[model samples]
Target: MTLIDLTPAPAATARANALPVAIIGAGPIGLAAAARLTERDIPFVVLEKGESAGAAIREWGHTRLFSPWEHLVDDAAVRLLGASGWQAPAAGRAPSGRELVDEYVAPLSAHPAIAPHLRTGVEVLAVTREGMDRTRTAGRSRAPFALRLRLADGTIVDETASAVIDASGTWGQANPLGSGGLAPLGWDAVADRVAPALPDVLGADRERFAGRHTTVVGAGHSAANTLIALASLARDEPGTRVTWLIRNAAAARISTGGDELEGRGALGARLERLVADGRVEVLDRFEILRAEPAGDGVRLHGRRAGEAAAHDTDLVVAATGFRPDLGMLRELRLELDDIVEAPRRLAPLIDPNVHSCGTVSPHGYRELAHPEQGFFIVGMKSYGRAPTFLLKTGYEQVRSVVAWLAGDAASAGRVELTLPATGVCSTSAGGCC
Candidate 1:
């Protein structure tokens, strides 16, 4: 998380002072940016693709987050929520995704300072300079950004802004079932049988999974969460069976924290107990190559130990993790790392091959800056293909970026972050998968 040198050119500075800053997405990080901007008295607008703030989190509302309330809530949001007499959740409690949205994100969005600036059901189709594309560079830094957005009423509108902060998260872009990151053959044909990464097994989605032979793919916290839920479901419905698949030869990648482990530690402990009880069959070294419709379910084709292997199951939860959507930023000038697609200077700190322990140093506006000034991609989207991003890190990112935007150079340059060390080293650079 080294803060690279970022001296906004004179032309870019002039443009930044001209109009309101536009923020993309209204998730936690996006709202955090709005909070910071509100505190600074900066004019800003939040464009959310979903109908309301934290809509994405609502999709996986049943799954509990490993991080506690303290780590999840941003400082600026707390300040605003406190003024409105909002009661904070217990710091030690690890809340479910839904609780995070309902308690913190939703309240923060509705705060008087943020509500007027927020616009939900507005999707940013593209972001570029007002009068220029990627090819044009003359006086590029002086031009305001033109954001083409699709409104809730199915009408397209173009808005102009002095700066753009893309906090749009990676939840929408799920990894495919095929090996090598490409979609498997006939992936679309079996779309109906492919279960999402995070599903509420004991809740609303119970009917789709109970008493069914399910296969949980990927070896990450998400997969672990699903496996734990499915195990609970299996206890009541003895006919239900779960198969855990991974590319690694062993389950060592699972983060089983020490006795001192607290919040997320419970998840690790639960997973360890589930493995010990042999509740879920482990299929190690299974590289999924393809998926096809097999009767009412799916047949996954892959290889294990140089031998072709196939698994037919009623449901396939490909919790292979997610990737940032780069499609919307095509017209913007960005210097991304060849491997991770993260900001060039920031990739080394997050690349799985380099930092396996998930300890990213503190970084800020400088590290997130792009060739196109006044533009920053924070949150999980900043990590690109890497999955090492934490909510705390995203909060820190907005704090610095907003500080810089407000012309507080001192605060922007002095970025600080403290994160718990995961002693476990991941086989993949990001998280478990």
Candidate 2:
């Protein structure tokens, strides 16, 4: 059966009475919000900066998730998937990024709950109040926030919504490898050699390193996946040397999912084995001070966390981290948290007293909403400097925002969903499920 009607033409005029909600980021969390909103019969639209669900996943398609399928499965996400007859794999293993996106995120977006509202290739630049609506902008009126978006095609559209959710992941911005600025010491004369955002593990440019020395920095899952993938190509491509430079004495590894070792848990073990096999060199607790020009390549200078000795490398891949873009909110009159610029207090259900999705920290949710009633930050960016809770937080935000918009303060306070514990995948074989 067709979940949505489409005859290649617009249908007859119908009252556009549904409440408008705009979700930024089409990843798991954004899609999940779409699903939840759809289930509640809420009318909304999803704007994805990337071309598809899990673009970051597609970038690292060769890599497996740190969490297993069970942990990966958000309750709402699973229900939507099930409705489409998408059976959960039984082995309970962590699937690769591609598999997770294709089988889960992409499929879920197509579900009846979210399909009509899913719009890809749209990048949300900012969320602010509607013009002349200072009452809502200042928290005095119950008007929703206005969203200013720039699509991939360069189209600028201003849309008003009862709420705004930001699910854009930390992966969008790459934390630079240099401190203060590009290391002033080495390669300063030819800084162009540095590729700010290096290609993802499966990026085409990665192929040029086939028979050369390469150094990878940072210790997150992205870095982990890159090391493993490069190691796998060693046998097929001779003279391919790998060096891992992490600040930790030993890599921090997290095993994820099922009885099978395919998740982050498995990758950690695999990395250890690769280290033992002498396929990759591990440089723990060191830092790069500068990249000095050396004959043909660059010599990297740095000291260990405690030691003063420096190190060297031919190529560097920094997987530091990311930060959010506050371009749209820069000039807004709303109060911003000193750190993250997110509304200090956000009560999605429209209640003036309740700040449901403010800060998920020891301080609880801060009062970022100010006196303004309609403004809200609904996704990962909402967390600001807070340790990102990932998709779970976004899901919670939307639930509260929807309730708040519906003017049910009591219901917003009562809205809570339990997330699955991490690990527990259905496929554990080969650790690349």
Candidate 3:
């Protein structure tokens, strides 16, 4: 892929250099971009909607990551952290979400070079050219970006930047539990009974799940993690019952790489033991059609195979995955695929339908470019609805994008990434987590 011409006209380049490159979200990918910019001596600012860095990761802090420390840490971040005498975590050790934030994200955000440019509790509502919308084309590349932000204290703020990098992730926009990718009937009315995808079953949310009959929907690893946790809860509280629901005819969707995989393989093995011991009931080929309020809990109506079937449960966990939020960029020019919603050029490379190995080739500024110059959507949000995103892939994306922004065309064009191969492909034909 060819890198776009990042250098502006002589007059525009002068003006652009005076302004800071505004980055949205303070997650790992966003912070890594900041570290790269710092190394290049580029002026930039980071805006996070949450009260602190890695705010989204904190929601599922109890869950351990499938990748180890070697795959999770970015090179630029390590260089910056190493200068401050920061010790790295054990190379082979896998960290929980909380530990990742506390050890890596928090320290990176506190670095002198990055800390001064970071701003938390600031939500970017919209992004557009200073005086032009998506319709205009002339001089659009030269104009600075205008951002509409919502502050923490119920106040609105307007900010401008030479360039905008949207690293905002897709954690909050979860897929629905209903069949055909739509919300089930009476879903909102019975919303109170539904549990978050990755709840702290054995910790803070123990009371809500103990002694309750719960059904987990989805065939991804998130579902596996929740099912394992529920089994542990059932062991302690004998009254607690757990059921797993999936649309596939067989449980082969669980791809266990055996000894080939590291942290993820161990999780797959634990889930296999649970299935063998009959601790968690697996209902395959079950498609949810509707959900209705029944007594204190909810009754789920669906079809098992071709016939009709239903299940009444006290709670449901929707681990169906998430989609990117494109509402904020309506006014900005973008080229997205119809199905995956990722950048047009990137969809073909990462689409689960075309590539089912759960591994995507490395992509950089070339694949991430949009019609609007100096604007990029990176990290998990760049993958749209695809679940094949890895932290290693996201780090490579920022490294290349930042190099281009800093006028290092050759560096930006050379994209390389190394990912652990999954021996088994996903049986459901959907991207793997």
Top candidate by TM-score? 3
Cα RMSD, each candidate: 3.2, 9.1, 3.2
Kindly report which residue stretches of model 3 are placed more than 4 angstroms away from their true locations once superposed: 1-13, 251-253, 258-260, 354-358, 419-431
Please report the candidate that would top lDDT against the real structure.
Answer: 3
lDDT by residue (1-433, candidate 3, tens digit) is 3234544321245676589999999989999999999998989999999999999888888888766677778999999999999999998777888999999999999999999999999999999988888999788777889899999896997888988899998888889988788999879878999987888999999999999999998877788888999999999996899999998876553567643345566767888889889998988898888889989888989899988998888999988888888999999988898999999898988786555334578789888988788899998889898877767778889999888888788888887666667422211112253
Decoy 2 TM-score against native: 0.73
lDDT of 2 at 72: 62
lDDT of model 3 at residue 358? 44
Cα TM-score of candidate 1: 0.92
**2 against 3, candidate with superior lDDT:** 3
- Given candidate 2, what's the lDDT at residue 95? 73
Q: What local distance difference test score does each model get?
A: 0.81, 0.57, 0.83
Q: How well does each candidate superpose onto the true structure, as a TM-score?
A: 0.92, 0.73, 0.93
